[model samples]
Target chain A: MTMKLWYWPEIQGRGEFIRLALEAAGIAYEDCARVSGADALIADLDARKGRAPFAPPYLDIDGFTIAQVADILLYLGDRHDLAPSRIADRYWVHQLQLTIADLVAEVHNVHHPVAVMDYYDDQKPEAARAARQFREERLPKFLDYFEQAAECNDGPWMIDHRWTYADTSLFQLIEGLRYAFPRRMATLTPDYPALARIHGLVADLPGIRQYLASNRRIAFNEQGIFRHYPELDDE
Target chain B: MTMKLWYWPEIQGRGEFIRLALEAAGIAYEDCARVSGADALIADLDARKGRAPFAPPYLDIDGFTIAQVADILLYLGDRHDLAPSRIADRYWVHQLQLTIADLVAEVHNVHHPVAVMDYYDDQKPEAARAARQFREERLPKFLDYFEQAAECNDGPWMIDHRWTYADTSLFQLIEGLRYAFPRRMATLTPDYPALARIHGLVADLPGIRQYLASNRRIAFNEQGIFRHYPELDDE
Candidate 1:
């Protein structure tokens, strides 16, 4: 049976991470939200009786539903060899995934620092403060961490000579960050050679190359987590 | 050899989740920061070669280190039978744990909305705005989700007849939220009877009860994730 993924249809958001992984692995799955409407998405979510996902992008596979981007990736990684075979390597990769998730949350907060419910226009001043800190401290810290992780493995991949979900996700992270903070990312990218190499490698992968060139891949926009607010992007 | 768990010593921060799990499982582990000092904690973190933990509350066990609160709990849960044996059940509980982690992050953000480095006083206006939204929309959504999760399993535990790490973490979440937002939690607690019941069950667990009574269990304070700024709490 094909897997079913549920997420907001309009934005790449967290759902893109899952889409990239599934595409890279050449796994066939249905994007439920894109096929159905937003009402269907809400209805499917509400219909889930118990222990339902707090929010999407949740995946239903093999008679069970799983939520959280990292958790979904972990499940996919284990089944498709997108993670390490050894126990410790798997945990290490998972730790990396969690850190990436943290970065994603912070990126979202850059535009909506004061409150998710409030309009970005209402929180512009707060977002400016948040974005400055994110561009200065948080972005460098995360990029440096990943650069170090890559150095440990002598990699374009997180694990030596092997592309896993971490590599694919890192590719998406750098892409999103670049789009969102082009000026800042341009200034900072030169400092993390290993991350750049991995990003390049992930783009060159056959599955990813095809997926990106095809219409299935969504473009980054202001509505998503990584929004390119000109005022927020700085060197 | 005993496992060495490292975290900031002063607060019952994220480390407490790890501590609670270890104590509940009757596992022996050394609190490295408490034994040493914050300087030692920094040195220990900085000395690590590569692919090191991005932050504290990392556990060193059996020649490998694991970080992230939920990931560490998942590791301990698998080894100690604090989680279910079935694969689906494990994922379900993990999803719950991830949701708890999300709540913990938001709880921290209530006091530090603008930037983590910026003082709370510097961002009071923004925090006030953030807290109002948190208390109104975010908190209830999370609590309702967990309450439903608990209700799904006929609880005193997240899963029927079994207490997993999700239950323990939920216990801590409730305790911390109450500490951080006394007025708000008091008003909200009655609405989530299943969660409150699980919280009580966790407190009464022989391991947790003893841990709480002992000096080892740190008290909640302003320095931690759940800080009680009376201005931030309301009905």
Candidate 2:
């Protein structure tokens, strides 16, 4: 039997990163929240007791559970041959994944600068200010680093021309940023040719192409992490 | 030869977490930024063109450079036997380290809520609100989870009786929070006795005790991740 993954049913949010990886690898697993209801998701999480994850997108397999997208990818990468076999290379890819995680957190913060629990309406002013910094400073900074990384490698992938979890994640980052800040990404696209190439390469992958076209992949919305706020986007 | 660790010279920021783990394990390494200068640190980092770290607190050892605190520690934890030997236990430890990383990022945001590049003075009102949420909700929530984790374990450490990098990180979290928000921590301290016990155990570790007493351990200040601001604290 395939393992069970638990996350919020509505938005792609952080869970989409995991979904992309699983789909890209053609791995089998059940998204519990989609099959069951959100209440079941909460109840299942609450029942974990002492070892509960701080948030969702956690995977339960063969009686062991793992959370943190990078950690999950780290485990899955090694098991399914998604990452390099060498220790140094593995750590390098994991480091990149952690950087992606940082970028994701900052993306979420742009919408909820004052408080995560607070709604966008309540924190619109702070969000506007944060969004400015993110679009003007952080977005370019993160993309430039990744573009340089991809260029340094011999091929479109992040490491040694191979499709590591980082490559899939970079694709998601680009896609999510485009969804959330279409105008800004359009303006900035010319500067990140390497990232653009990698994104294209990942999009062409058979599994990803199928998954993206299918209903299993959720749409981006205000409820998600990378929300498309028109006020938040700028050239 | 010992590894070379690069970070800011003046403050105990993210680098201190790595420093604490290495110190707790009695691992020898040169604090490159302290010996050389902030300029030298910048030059060294800038020179790693292809895969440079997004920011500081990176480690260069045996010709391999690793960034991200948790990744560096994950690499070190296995070689130095600071983490568990089993694969499952190792991933578990890494997951905890990732969670600690999340908490560390949130702690930094409390002081610079509106912008990372902006001074606290410019975002005082926003910082005040962010700090309140952090101190009242986030700090307790994170500490509570870790406290329950500690209680579930057989000993004072995060996993089975042996000390791991997670234990060292928990120590840094507690110490940093106390320094950054003394009054807030004092009020909330009674609720997390397991974490307190883990902190005490880590403090008493002979190697850590020696390192703490030595001049090598940098003190907390305004420049670091955990900064003291009277306005951001509440009883």
Candidate 3:
């Protein structure tokens, strides 16, 4: 049976990470919210009785539902061969994915530092301060860690020679950061050659290439986690 | 072989969640940072060659190391019977743990709204704003979701009658929140009867009671993730 993914239809947000993985694995699934309106998505989520997802980007597969971007990736990794076969390696890949999730959350926070419910216009000054710290410290620290992971492996993949879900997610992270802080990423991107190489490699993958060209991939905008406000970017 | 847990020596932070699970399962492991020094912990983390952890609260078992609190708990859950036997149930439990992790991160962010590297005092204004939003919206939303999970189950546990790592982690989450925001928690506690019930049940567990009475359990302090700042709390 075809799996169903429920998320906000307009923005990629966390759901894009899952979309990338399914596309990479050439798996068949329906983007439920995209097909049905977001009201339907909310109703479906509200209707879930037990073990309900806390937020969107939940997948309903074979009668069971899973949520949390990293957890969903972990479930997908096991089934789609998107992770290493060895148990230790699988955990390591998952650890990397969890770290990526942390980075994504921080990226969202840069624009919404004081209050998630508040608008960026209300938090712009705080966002500016947050963006500076993120660009200087947190972003570099995370990039360095990912680059180290790539360097430890045999090739551009997170694991030895084989690309895992972590790598695809990493590609999305780099893409998001670059879009959000083009000047900052431009200055720092050269320092992390391994990450740059992995990003390029993931972009060239046939599945990712196809997905990127398709209309199914939503363009990053102010509404999504990674927004370009120009002022949030630094040189 | 005895497992080794590495985290910041002083604060409960993320490490406490893993500690609670291990304690609940009656597993004996070394709190490596407490035995050694923080310097040693940093040296150990820095010295690892490949597949190194992004941050602390990593567990070294047998030969491999697992990082990320949820991931570490997932590993321990499988070996120590800390989670359900069924694969679907295991994933559901893990999903709950991940949500708890998200809440923990948000709690930390409430104090460090602008920059994590900066002192909380530096971001006091921003933190005040964050704390208001957290208490007004995020905290209630999270509590409501977790309470629903507990209510849906056979008992106070997140899953059926048998308590899992998720239950232990939720217990800690509630405890930390109370310690951090007593006034806010006092007003909100009655609204989440299931969570309060689970907290009471977990505290009564022999292993947890022993751990709490022992020197192993660190007292809640300002340095920890759940800092009890009077200004941050509201009635």
Q: Score every model by TM-score.
A: 0.98, 0.99, 0.98
| Ranking, lDDT, top scorer first | 3, 2, 1
Candidate 2 lDDT tens digits, A88-177: 889889999999999999999998887877798988899999999999999999998888878888766899767889999999999999
Model 2: residues with Cα > 4 Å off, grouped in runs? none
lDDT of 1 by residue, B1-235 (tens): 8999999999999999999999888889999989898899999999998768999999998668899988898888778888988888887888888888888888888888879878899899989999999999999999999888888885468985878898889889999998888888889999999988889999989999999999898888888898989999998
- The residue pairs found clashing in candidate 2 are none
Best model per DockQ: 3
Docking verdict class for candidate 3:
high
lDDT of 3 by residue, A80-136 (tens): 788899888888888898999999999999999999998999999999999999988
Question: What RMSD does model 2 have?
Answer: 0.9
**Predicted structure with the largest lDDT when compared to the true one:** 3
- How displaced is residue A77 in candidate 2, in Å? 1.0
* Residues B18-49, model 3: lDDT tens digits: 99999988899999999998999999999998
- Determine which window of 10 residues in candidate 1 chain B has minimal summed lDDT: B154-163
Compared with the true structure, all predictions reach lDDT values of 0.89, 0.89, 0.91
Q: Is the docking of candidate 1 incorrect, acceptable, medium or high quality?
A: high
- What is the per-candidate TM-score for chain B? 0.97, 0.97, 0.98
Instruction: By DockQ, rank the candidates, best first.
Output: 3, 1, 2
All predictions: root-mean-square deviation over Cα? Answer: 1.1, 0.9, 1.0
